[model samples]
Target: MANTTSAKKATRKIARKTAINKARRTRVRGCLRKVEEAIAAADQAAASEALRIAQSELMRAVSKGVFHKNTASRKVSRLSKRIKALSA
Candidate 1:
């Protein structure tokens, strides 16, 4: 229900941005899941590697505004802590 031409254009732009953001969110979640799976399996090496990749992807998502900076940091921190605990 975009009445004006500009409104229609804005809607289109929003749709494109929504798609991109959704993809980024999915990617970040996938990365986090990989880390969690590794942790659950108690594989220290795999968990460590997955955490590294997840941290990178999470930070990237933060940069893209898919997640807040502190949110990403907290997730990374908690996951790293879990990974450390795996070694103990």
Candidate 2:
């Protein structure tokens, strides 16, 4: 349905970006889930480590434009707070 060559190229670029963004989102969710699981299990060390990983993933996603920087920061802050509370 793309009527122009440029439109076809744009479609291709969008598809590739979509796939990449999806992968980044999936990875961030997994990392967040791992941190949540560790917190639920009351493993402070594991939770801390997982949070660290999740925070890094979030930051990376933000830098890559998959997520807003403030959004990532808020997520990291909330997760870290929960993790800290679990340790206390």
Instruction: Give a tens-digit lDDT track for model 2, residues 6-83.
Output: 999999999999999999999999999999899889998999999999999999999999999999999999988987
List candidate 1 segments past 4 Å from native.
none
Give Cα-based local distance difference scores for all models.
0.93, 0.93
The TM-score, computed over Cα atoms with residue i paired to residue i, of candidate 2 is 0.96
Q: Which digits, one per residue and each the tens of the lDDT, describe model 1 over residues 1-88?
A: 9999999999999999999999999998999999999999999999999889999998888888999999999999999999999888
Native-structure RMSD, model 2 = 0.7
Which predicted model would earn the best TM-score? 1
TM-score of each: 0.97, 0.96
Single out the weakest 10-residue window by summed lDDT for candidate 2: 79-88
Model 2: residues with Cα > 4 Å off, grouped in runs: none
